[model samples]
Target chain A: MSKKLVEAMADLEEDAVLAEVKALKAQNVPALDIIAYLQEGMSIVGKRFEEKEYFLSELIMSAEIFNEASQLLGGGMGGAGSSKYGTFVMGTIYDDIHDIGKNIVTTVMSSNGFNVIDLGVDVPTAKYVEAIKQYKPKVIGISCLLTTAFDNIKECIQTLEKEGLRKDIKILIGGGPVDEATCKYVGADHVCKNAQETVEYSKKYMGV
Target chain B: MKTNKELYNERLTRIKKAIALEKPDKTPFAPMMDSFCARHMGYTLAQFCFDVELSNKIMIDSIKDLGEVDAASGTSSFAGGMGLIFMCRVKLPGRELPENALWQLDEQELMKPEDYDTIISKGWQAFSNEYVATRMNVDFELLGKTGAFAPIADQRMREAGYPVYGGGVVSLPVDYLSGGRTMAKFMMDIKRMPEKVTEVMDIIMKNNIETMKAGLKAAVDPIDVFIAMARGCPDFYSTKIWEKFVWRYLKEVTETCIEEGIAADFHIDANWERGLDYFKDFPKGTCVFETDGMTDIYKVKEKLGDIMCIKGDVQAGKLTLGTPEEVYNYSTRLIRDMGPGFILAGGCSIPPNAKVENVRAMVAAAAGK
Candidate 1:
């Protein structure tokens, strides 16, 4: 790693994005450079999670940290051209607004450079379609915390399918209500266990 | 022919005797208030939760409707800022929000001690400014009298992202204020300075003496009842954490209640599977413990008998989805099996949409009047 990369890694470990941005700005490290450093940090978190060095609690915190850093950067960092990552529409699905997990996903996606548009909670199916038509998100992440509304995901996926947008949208499902069968039942392209996994799986799903 | 003092003493003795579970003027049916049932009385959950005036109206109306519920209390969430996530209720199908979802603040983003203090000052304002109405059918006045809280602290750390039940018990408001500081930075501190763990707890109860004195002023029945509720939850860092982080503070709180002659209750439903041992330590009758779906309240008969009131039996969903027959059978069986010692309540708060018929059935089943 170069000196700039080493310094960026140190800032990432500090979990201080504002400080990281300041250092980067001082060093003339562009927004993409900071994002790559963030990606490296997240990968480390994911590896630690796989090694059982971190827990769900830590995963969320890390994801949230990344989100705060990205929010600070806003749209000013990528220099010229499109976002170095992509775009995503994420939410707690319709009727199940438990955002701790959803927010974690949003943070990780944003940290990975995805412009995540959080539709908020209890988002209706039409809203997803409208957002897709509006922003053309590369993927759609649906979250839920209620066991009672587990079946609603099927509605969300099917609406996309009916609208002939299923082929275009990569539907990722997660949260307490998500299970292996649920992931398969709702035709989700990927099932994520935590925020790190969500970001990792989205990368795989997006073939990035 | 009886002396005036003798008669006055006798009546007082009778009431005391009744509360002590010996004998009294019939059985005292102090049914804990269920806010989920308040919707049946025609109040929005938003109105019932945030505004005290509306909550009191729903309470008055519900108590009036049941004509059997003895207590005028409401749900507890004073410190839990999980309601903030409720701002996103627009994302779900039928637009339903998940129950008790918490706002898991990012650990790494926790403000430095100085910045946190600044946020703490402004956070209270942020909390007030961020309040949104859930439009739930309920009342406000009755809500206040019974301790329905305004999100003073967003204690979501224990409930969310932690994969565990939490226990929160402190003796003083000042201690609680200080404890909030310790908790907000707990994760970061734990990782960065693992050796300072004991000091973390030191900061939690530093002003116990004054806090206990304040606890005296806020007495209603007692804070012990609320403690019983906490004892039943799961992710509270285990029984060990309880002993280290909060037991002494609770002891101070419970001890104060004892000194003031006020009754208290403890509730820690859902993850109370191993809580029986914790129940054994409580000074009998000083408080009550409520459990939920995963617990067997009957175990208390053998271990916790005469120790504390063990309430909760009807499942929130059963009371919502089950027929009146099912609710009646569930309540009657619990009241009879748990006997006269326990309270008959939902395993947790009854849902806002719970059917009224089911609530009435449970009340009738418990009282049999």
Candidate 2:
């Protein structure tokens, strides 16, 4: 592990992080090892976020830097198989095309070691069920910025229960208008106030 | 019964008094609603999005049903106008999705990094006109029809005994650029080219201020200007970054409002507990700190109660999912604890699926029954 690479990534020194990735590559560092260092750096970023020393800006910046450095190693960090944490399925519920919140959660989740399956915005209930049957993720996040989509979320949760898939995984809901009342109304397990909370909740659920 | 004109004058006085931090006889109910009004009047979302006159009629009818509303933030809405506010494309209910679906902003990286230089060189109006024409996929005929109908809609609301609260809407440069560039890419741009971003923002702010001043001058009843700043909330950035990019411009815009003899209604979304103190510097009675439920409303009252009028924070979830009794009790508590200078409103816009009885309960709370 290169302490410099980890520190550079954690500090969000883009140039330094990129330079270190190239230097380590020149010295024949294995791609997986470099990816591990980058993940370690992201873990530190998450820590700073939890402590409130860094905010969403830092998290996005850190993720951008991590992706750039990963590209230097021939882009092998794309799949769920390489993740240390279990898979996470995420989507914006049906009829809600707002994707900023969903994208943020997925990006932060990916940077924090979860293999995130982003179902994209306006995702229907059947799509979510298909993803669950295929990926069998331990946690799933549903995002909805419109209050109109609340029933859709409730219906989605009910469908999961009907399919006997609700017992095995945790369901988290979030977005601009969602609250504790929304969580109860939608039958979601928890309502994440921000991306960091999503990461923390998923980590605890996964025993990571 | 008082004439509608008399009622309009009385309500306007009450709202203005609240903004000036003086106690009116009663707390005002100036709800900011759109889709909720449509749904309340038994119109589909597609009907509301397609017909501006129908939207106006729905808003008027819904406000009348609520009873004792002092004002509305707006009595009509055009989905096409959203492209201007968000600086991106919108997928209308009838056009892009199911007919009854709520409209959504299709945020993508529509504005490139080089577009900042284009904005700086050509001014916001020129660049934005072209961007809307070419990039936003908006129908020009619909845009024109809606644009022509706005004043008429405002007039109809005034005729129906409701004074409108905000004359026009403005946004921080970051909101437009972030929506155009997408939040992640804009945040990256802030880091990659801080100086250029700062330069571009300065140009945009100048253009916005000029347009705002002109609008205020042109309005027969310019009570306040709605300043949308959800994306620039301090929750999204550290103190240093927020102070530089968000707060600096916010302070400037508020100061401009103060100078222009109008109030600045900050349509703040998301959690903003960390940045409440920054608002303290604005002169007392010059601004309204409107929050969605994400930020603790009680904290706002505790900190800026004596300084500015606090509007809002009936959470959308409560209005949609909770019972009428719950909404009544919450809104009554808000009026009790945060009033003397409080204007009751939804956290942001009332959710389209909100129960009609829940909204009536909120209005009844403001009416003290």
Highest-DockQ candidate: 2
B60: Cα error in model 1, Å: 4.1
Look at candidate 2 and give me any clashing residue pairs. Answer: none
Superposing all C-alpha atoms, what RMSD in Å does each candidate have to the true structure? 10.7, 1.6
DockQ of 2: 0.80
Tens-place lDDT per residue, model 2, B93-198, is: 8898777787878888899999999988998889988898888868678778888888898899999999999875688998898999998899899999998999
DockQ-based class of model 2: high
lDDT of 1 at B96: 35
Model 1 alpha-carbon miss at residue B224, Å? 4.0
Docking class of 1: incorrect
lDDT by residue (A1-208, candidate 2, tens digit) is: 7999999989999999999999999999988888888888888888888789988898888877887888888773353247888999999998888887787798788878898888999899999999999999999999999888898999999999999999999999999888898899889999998887898999899999
> Tens-digit lDDT track for model 1 on B74-126?
42322123222221112111113233222122112212344333434454334
The runs of at least 3 residues in candidate 2 whose Cα sits more than 4 Å from the true structure, single-residue gaps closed, are none
Task: For candidate 2, give the lDDT of residue B282.
Answer: 86
How many backbone clashes can be found in candidate 2? 0
